[model samples]
Target: MAIDLYALPVTQVSGVKGKKPEELLALGITSVGQLLDYYPFRYEDYTLRDLTQVKDGDKITVQGTIAGVPQVQMYGRTKSRMTCKIVVDSLFITAVWFNRHFLRDKLTAGAEIVLTGKWDQKRLHLTISETEFPGQGKSQTGTLQPVYSITGALTQKWMRQTMKQALLQFGELIPEVLPAELLTRYDLLPRKKAMALLHAPGSLEQGQQARRRMVYEELFLFQLKMQAYRALNHDRADGVAHPVDLPAVRAFVRALPFTLTASQKQVLAEILHDLQQPHCMNRLLQGDVGAGKTVVAASALFAVVKSGYQGALMVPTEILAEQHKRSLDRLFEPYGIQTALLTGSLTDRQRRDLLASLQMGLIDVVVGTHALIQEDVYFRQLGLVVTDEQHRFGVNQRSILRRKGMNPDVLTMTATPIPRTLAITAFGDMDVSTLRELPKGRKPIQTYAVTPAMLERVLGFIRREVSAGRQAYVICPLIEESEKLDVQNAIDVHAQLQFAFPEYRVGLLHGRMTASEKDEIMRQFSSNEVQVLVSTTVIEVGVDVPNSTLMVVYDADRFGLSQLHQLRGRVGRGEHQSYCILIADPKNEVGKERMKAMTDTNDGFEIARRDLELRGPGDFFGTKQSGLPEFRVADMVTDFETMEQARDDAAELVRRPDFWTGASYASLRQFLQRENIFTGDLLD
Candidate 1:
């Protein structure tokens, strides 16, 4: 159904009458429904009151009689904020208003008003920046106050008032979506009731319940959309079955220098089964670092080859692509699997040769970066596509690759094992295969957190490692010092190491270096030409030399837990024991906590959980990194359990797809469309 403009009601304050709806639309507040549905970003709870509970300088609601008159000072104003003071319950608190002083009149002396604001405990004074009155009732300040996201033209008060008015006027449009039976069974309030509680609740408990209802609803709807997509895909006619020759893949694995681990074999079996499915495969491969995702991917590629079809592997960066190509080339050579590399960095002659091989169907396994998805590129018989660190690429890029084939099986691999809650909420539409165990003979990288005082010992250890014919890696925080202050740099550290240990060779690598320079440095380190390599995180995944055993990270606190884990993965690649030392400051609690968490557990999943609990979803998941959904109400971290239940409900709803044909589901879809929560970007 098309959007119903009448579903949203107009408010007297939405516009000044003569201005444009087009103008309002530009502000993302076009429809009355949008205005009503524009939920608050946060809430300020100032409903609790009582002088007995109030401490000195506390921003509290004192119900005592006002003993003095308020004062308004003509303080010099810059571009914002005004200076004023008001007395409530015989206590003095500074009042600051942005541009509006109409508050002065409403907050008269001895007027028995409740002021809500911040306070300085040391100064024994409160900054009553906001005011409330009994006449305004609970609208001004209640258990939960709606704090809508606002533009310059819309103040918090304005948004609240406009939403309140819209709610009052558009009573007929706010239809309920959940069944009456389910509502009563789940003890959930109606949307209208929840909205009321959200804006103005009589008690904190009511506001929490209302929040729970809204969050669950929002999560359920999102999950339902995902399940719908899954259902729709399931209904599509599957492609021809591409049978997998398990014997061939097993023989290839058996011929390998190392034996496949239980987890690797398990995941490989799942991938093989997926490739054999008549439907085009859309699988997610989640494996911890050093869990042998590459071998599993190779096995899938073998199946593709056995089926008389070619496979394509895409990486996010040219460096990583080159690395994967080199690694896969070695593995495929013994099996007579014709493999080739294609990337932007390749010379014209090289690219032409590679393209020729690809077009001729001679390259059985082609690995490259986004260059594979270029418009000019064509595949002879691309049967399967493997994307390494698939999370780094956006959904659009993934889709573009899929469109390159006749619906080839897609196997996306990620080094990070996403939390289960995130996988459900963010990647519910895709099938997932997890490689949870590390391969045999891999030593656990011992991790430690130390202060600057231990720096000398760390350097001494590096010297000892290099002297023993093994290599070590020292990662600096930055390439150059900032203008703010001069900090240690990779270049400077390399020089320092060379000078201190004149007996050993030291090399430096950073992001600022040229590709040739980075390659040369990496080549040197790989061949053990350089005993010690000092660099930035650029080498975090660049090379895989087992000789490097000692890993030292300077200012480890600056890096996220997952990032630190990734860096630690650079070492301990060999059978010998390896160590990761994190040098940090002990006094900084945030830094200390991050370091402690890293040291406390070598488990990536545990680290991720702690990272979430300590820093929230944004910092833990690296919003920019994960591309995870950012919900204002639903938190995948704190609300994991609830999100699971919502996901189940979503699945059930999708099984009964006709439920959305109802007017209520239409309205629900309309609400989601307005919020961009179910936008096509998610599935693209």
Candidate 2:
């Protein structure tokens, strides 16, 4: 019988005792298996090199004999410097160590030593970052040394020694989680051999090979769990097969004031096709802002309601909900399709009356915020559910809304375009449909990035635009002055603009205001009562003012690329030419890149790809909200090809009848059960 390395504590290792165990625990390494799995974030090459082959300012590792006793000089209260001379290949070089007075006794005359650091060929000097005696227990001089992230007085030397001990004792006991056939098919290293190579590799190529194996393993496990969830959802028998009336739906589409774009038509066709399937529709509908997604969604709701079933549209904010309800009401008016709005701000009596109407099947469709998912809210034969701006809501919130009916068909919509790599990993379980074409006759917004020195000119442009009977919006990052950030706030900007343009009406809006107050301010802005509206990012999503042609964003460097694109989207909605002026003085390369990307093109997909590369997957959409998993060795950006292959393999394997019960799959089943991968819902 094999011992379970995962159950053995870190103390069971030879030298991981006393404070060492506590230190290891601080890094979340409680068991022997975990300690081994804590792979290095990077590696440092300490391969010994010849002095003749080294150049000036080259980082080199060399072994030599100390020519003299080291001397230590104390400076200030606790700072000290040690100097010594060493002979490498018959060339004398002075080595310096800062704040390492303890090494003075260790470096005696004629002692063999290994030093690694940058060399200054002109001065024959080396600033030593590490020192190792030639006869040390295990030398890392001629190899790639692993660099681990440490804390609590733990040194790399101690970590390497303890890891060698753990591997020597329990390496063979590391069970193989993947099947043997898979190992041979992919030409991957065995689990035990890979673990050993990760800690102590002979060369960079060897370490990369080891890392490839781990990356494939992590991605395979993630895909397997995603495929299992998809299978479970597909196998459900309680799904409602909503009716798809193409003739009626097309007629409704034809009656709209504007013609539907080719992309919108294709997406609506996909949604209608899913409605007739045996299983519920789990699909993601994504597009850039002003892509006409609402009209496509409205057509789907019309089909469900015409078939004698109800539909629900859930948004993120009350303002958005109200906007949807008003638009949906106008669209459904010709056919006498009734629509109602529900929000947290509704009165108790009004809420009770609406709930009663919905339960009694009197309401054909309802649009709401999170109020749609409350315990008291009920629906009569809800056949379709549409969530707008899907990323704003949590997974549980969406799930609760689906629970209102018998596995109703779901259509999730987002204005933020997600890259193909992220779409495959983060939303792998759902089928995706993208809308890339905007409506006809829509013009691109002219964008520019300017420094604070151009503030007066920008204000003058706004003044001219406003004097032409148009409105403008001035956006800030913060609601009030924050001690930590030096960016402009909404209140101060509003005050300044009000003073600068005494003849115009300037209004302030932020997240700190009440819903009704926000509604009133927005109402004023929409009606052109407030010509210059100074606000924060609270107006990024649903506030649409076609008359507002100018958008001036202060401290635009503080926002992400996607966010800036969204702010730029607020304008360019009307027929008149619009402009977006970005006021920023970027201090870093990434900020400069963002500014360039914004001013270069108006394609949201290109902007999204750049954002993913600059900010990485963790901050792309925010890891928690994005539903992206934290991997041990795999990176979402660099390892996207591995992820794609893993997804295909998992999909193929899950279709096998014996995958869940075969003896060859016992290890995978055990691993999944131990990790609790299947216990939770997908994308939660």
Candidate 3:
């Protein structure tokens, strides 16, 4: 009888007993099926190679006989090195192992073994990383060895043996999820064959083929979930059909201080069209920093208000909320649109009055931080909901705000330029509108990378800029000194700057400060009461100060490209020539690449694309904050082409008449149901 792989516990496998099951469980591997799915993160090729072809730093595997007596040397109290001479393909070479003194007894002269490590051609040496004694029945020559991420007491040898035993027992019993048509269309290996190849591929090409199939499978399933949600949202009939007064919205746009960019106008049109539809406007408005997303969002809010419905704008931070409130208040005052601000810092009585006004329809639009989603905060007729820096809020938080109204239109705005592949995967359920053009009169920020040795010069430059009646910002990665990291801290930097520029005031800001303190500090900086503001990344998204012309980031290499771009954006908002100086001494290639990318171009999209390549999707926007799905094999950067194919296929499949019920899709439906990919009435 065949075993049910998904139901069989991993402990049922040979050697996976006692604490072994618990260790595997830590990796989310509780069932035999899951254990098989735990594919190797990397592979080491142990195929025997010619000695003459090996270079000094080439990592190669060679089979040889122990040619000399092994010598063990003890240096430090707990340090030792065992060295021996090995003969491989009639060529003698030295093999060394560090802190492995026990190997001296086992590595007898004339013992036949397979060794893999970096070959030092100049010294005719092989630093032994792995050893296989042929007499002991462990020969891995001419094969690729799978390397897995293991926990306590789980070595590579044990993991490989257990996996081999599991495959022998239930490999044939593993079921296929994708239909036969897709398998033939994509030229994919069978599910069982792919699993076998992934665990123990005969060649590198076979391993790559196996990985391709798995990546496609994961991406396809993920896109299916996204497509289903999108379909469900589109099918909802309870969405508001707001009266889109184009002329009124146009007039509001015309009344703006500056003319809207062409990109902004195009996106505004898309947003207004969505407002007139019966389905809720589930759209994402993304642009580079300094792009006019707010104007477009304000226009949508105006249209909603003109239709006799209130609007709610939620921001991530109180400072940003207050800034938006002040800007919108100034813009909407002439039109008689009442706007109110609600934040956590408000007093009890103040909060009560604001809630009452919101509930009584006295406020046309409400701008606040997370306070807008409170249960007691009622909206008389909520029509549209706009969230700035949408990545800062979780899906549940956004959903709660949307639920406060009767299918209100949601417009999520972000200054971060999301890559096309990530947008399709992460924000796949929402329609995307991009504004790539900056508003007129905005100058590109001049960015430069300098070493710590040039700190004096940077300070002198900042002094000169401040002397000219302009403000400056100095950013640090940490708020206080840390034992582990040696990067500059905000508090110490603030003190140093105050001492260096004794004539000017340097205000300190960090996340640890209270809201009122931060607001006060920002107020002083905006009014030029403080000539320089020293802070952490809390100012990454703050009230814009056009007078701040110089931004000096200490240890800028410690920051991601997107973050560095955002910090640079704080400056260059005014008419004066702006500069961003990155003070860093990068130690790695990735760190150097970040600095180069920052200094190369001021385009946020290009910076974001490079950042995604450097940091990957998981760290791009933080998975929890951005709601990006985690996949085992599919990478949002390298496997983008495959993702696009999967997205197109999933979109087509979800539209089929028998997508949810047909025999061809029975396995797909069952898999999605068992995995709980589609919840509620999505599958129905």
Candidate 4:
């Protein structure tokens, strides 16, 4: 069947009016085919009719009449309620209406209609004011109805009507993208038939099958697209191969002030192998907070520089860029390697000078945000591109930078730990390196979760830390509770802390503040000018201060387990004994569970596994950043077995590259392109 793409209407439902076929088509509702596919936002079940199944106190749907007049009464000044006696067959029940004046007229005495609502079995009362139509159906066996996405102006009734019309007109117009043989083999429903049953299933079993087939197709097509994307990347681009110089790297390592941990050395070897490979490198470097990822990144930078090629380290924030520049400059300046920082906040002269230096190849290492990849900032001999946090960069932007010249090797660094199983599925195209150990002599942060009642003791601990010449961070649960609710805001907390500790310098930082203002506050804190930094979670990922040893997180029960762990990691970086005090309300069990997870272990990997187990796959440590193919039905946490099967299926498909060719591949490719999974430019 040929699809009349031109005949199909694509009008917004808001402005829809009179149902003239021509007017409907003019508004882009050309045919019944388009109308039937108009899905609903939700379904209301009024199907059940048996009143005996409903207990005396149970709320239910029943067909009855207004046997007696409604008794009305007023409540306070504005509210009123009316209760009417109703009966269905031999069963008697009472129905009540609240603030329903017009209902008195709408429901008259001796009227026969179906009422949809709940009943109070013990009270022998029912709330029968839901609907007048007998639209709900009863299941011989219990089943659930499905709801589709919708806009405010379009209702379930409108959708059902449009769908009915579309089925009458253009139900046969939609062409099947899946091959006939595949459909039969998979026992999948045809597109038109599926739409018919999806809107109006004959049985609960049919609905289940329909949902399973649709969800499978969605997930399978997604996998198919991701495979095609990987294929395009594999077929076209050639990676720059710059093998590690072990002897020179060893010499540099020996000259460092601290010894490298076994974990760090192992990760370096994995990265070195990728750098030496012929394929363009796409690798993720995951380390716990303060696990020394910067040092590992520096080593890769050194390797890039030693190979006579320029390297760039792109961070997500300006403060992080400055921190990286200051730290890298100190380490590399001794080796005569020049490092330059470029951020949006830089003055015109500074930016121009930096760009010129980069163009001239005078700056061997460049560190900045998206500013580094802007078209004007060209590298003379770009070889390596290291992104500090993978989540901040999109695939398109990263690909554009890789296209800059010579297809520079890409390495992405993240502080979020991911389990090995998911890493294989989500980042199948990339290698992985993990630094699971902290640097030697790093103090273990002593963690505790306390209630607000222990405020004085907490204040005394802070005073002791401050009097010892160290600084602390006091973070609120939110930036502003005024905009939201039930969360501690940083602004209010800052004001309260200012009054409580008048002698201490308390500075505020949050998303609401200007970038320059945030930078100034951060600089002051770093320079010890501010003894207390009161802020939101904006400081979770990037900010690094060794001197700040204490972290007091308010409403700690409100944050995620991984987030709580990350916040706790902000401390215990320096030699001094650091502490993280979690101020949580005792009544919150959910919050207590999360806080307990932190006090139990500092291992990010274990915490991540437990988080996945507790919250399910959707809330895993770094699943949001993992970029896994979006699955509507497959729960990564609960459907681990199915996920494993999907991964295996994807791998098998990749191995047989020619299996998805001809018209089959054309449809798959179109689907992928529509979903923005694969770009048309294979080389890019």
Residue 60's C-alpha lDDT in candidate 1? 52
The 0-to-1 C-alpha lDDT of every candidate, in the order given, reads 0.74, 0.89, 0.88, 0.73
Report the lDDT tens digits of candidate 1 across residue range 424-472. 7667777888887888888888888988898788888887778778899
**Model 2 Cα displacement at 649 (Å)?**
2.5
Instruction: Give per-model CA RMSD.
Output: 4.4, 3.8, 2.8, 5.2
Backbone collision count in every prediction?
1, 0, 0, 17
* Residue 5 lDDT in candidate 4: 48
The 10 consecutive residues of candidate 4 with the worst lDDT sum are 134-143
- Model 1's alpha-carbon lDDT is 0.74
Model 4 clash tally? 17
Task: Count clashing pairs, candidate 2.
Answer: 0
Top-TM-score candidate index: 3
Task: Please report the TM-score between candidate 1 and the true structure.
Answer: 0.87
Residue clash pairs of candidate 1: 8-33
Off by over 4 Å in 1: 1-28, 48-113, 120-123, 131-143, 200-202, 484-487, 618-627, 653-684
Q: Measured by TM-score, how close is model 3 to the native structure?
A: 0.93
The sequence of per-residue lDDT tens digits that candidate 4 reaches over residues 1-684 is 556544555442333455544544443445444555444334455565587676655545677777888788888876888888887877777887787756777566887756666778776677655656333353322223445555435455555655555555556666666556557866888866776677767666676566556555555665565565676676444777786787877777788778889998898878777777766777778888888888888888898788788998888777778889998987787789999888888899999999999988999999988887788878898988898876666666666666665878888888767777666556655667889888989877889999999989998999899989899999887776665567678988889888888998999998777778988999999999999999888888768788999999998987878777878888887778999999998999888788788888889888777777767655554444435555544455654554555555555665675655656656655666676755534322
